[model samples]
Target: MMAGTPSRNELHEQNRLSWNEATKAHNSHKGDQAKFFREGGSTLFPEEIELLGDITGLSLVHLQCNAGQDTLSLARLGAIVTGVDISDEAIAFAQKLSQESGISANFDRADIFDWFEETATAGKQFDIAFSSYGAVCWISDLNLWAKGISNILKTGGRFVVVDFHPVAMIFDTDWSHKFSYYSRNRKCTQ
Candidate 1:
């Protein structure tokens, strides 16, 4: 390591491992997730999705679509959605949910970077690319990731992101430094 240099992957393996573990945890709790969401549905719906303007026949892509929650959410709004993640277990669970919920969509598991390359080579482009909360920082380079988004999005297509503010990222609620989890804290707020 060079003087004053840090030890971190340009693309962190820690992020990937964490996601893998999260997929496990999510599957362990999968039986309850849909029920939990139904009890307190959000204001977000197809109308909010339509506010982005016409997507009458547009294709949508959601990257890092954990367990396909919001991905199915989008499919319900009429956009044809294909969700990609690196967790096969999560993807399988999502597919099962898709079948049961009657949301027509597809899910696949692949590393995010390779996903970009393969999609491009397949001559695919999306009308909308959506990602929410925490997925961006896990990526190796924001600029490169943005470029991939550009490659994936057609002319006039849009990419949207919603995430917790940086300041909120610090300070673990469980008092654990360097590993803040949100489950218990979000529950307290609710």
Candidate 2:
């Protein structure tokens, strides 16, 4: 391997550790998750909710589903939901949330890439594959991500991604932007 190239196992482990660390803060005072659920507020943003219109009875897989608030929301919306996350802590928390909220769901602890293969092999394609808000940045290869989406989705399935613009990553610490936005067909690089 090249000096900076991580083996797949190493990459997965690194991300898993990072997400495990983040889970506490993400589910606690730093986030509105508790308030949202307690007050019956939606965890999903308006754009995502609009995109996921009328998911009643649809089978949906939520990729990179950290803590699974959105996944639980989808279940409450009447979709059969499966939430996949890399962090075991996140999956556990999601399962706990499902139980507390009385919303039915399946939570899987696996890397996004592996989840796709597992589902595909099990012949468990879904009507929708969804992710939102900073999830894609954790993926090392967008091509593999796209292929995974294809592998586990039915022919007419919808895939929705609601995330910050990739260009946001280009800004400096002082917020002095450097790149002029332009149209290009290119994979994002970190």
The top-ranked prediction according to TM-score is 2
Candidate 2 lDDT, 120-143, residue by residue in tens: 899989999998998876677778
Candidate 1 lDDT, tens digit per residue, 1-190?
5676433442344555666787877678546555544454322455446554565567989888878888877776678989988766778878877776666788978777778889998999999988877676455556777888899999988997776665555567874565345433221100
Give the C-alpha miss distance for residue 178 in model 2, angstroms: 7.9
Worst 10 residues of 1 by lDDT: 181-190
- Against the reference, the lDDT scores of all candidates come to 0.70, 0.82
Q: Give the TM-score of candidate 2.
A: 0.86
The runs of at least 3 residues in candidate 2 whose Cα sits more than 4 Å from the true structure, single-residue gaps closed, are: 30-39, 177-190
Q: Give the per-residue Cα lDDT of candidate 1 at 20.
A: 70
Clashing pairs in 1: none
Highest lDDT: give the candidate number. Answer: 2
How good is model 1 by TM-score? 0.74
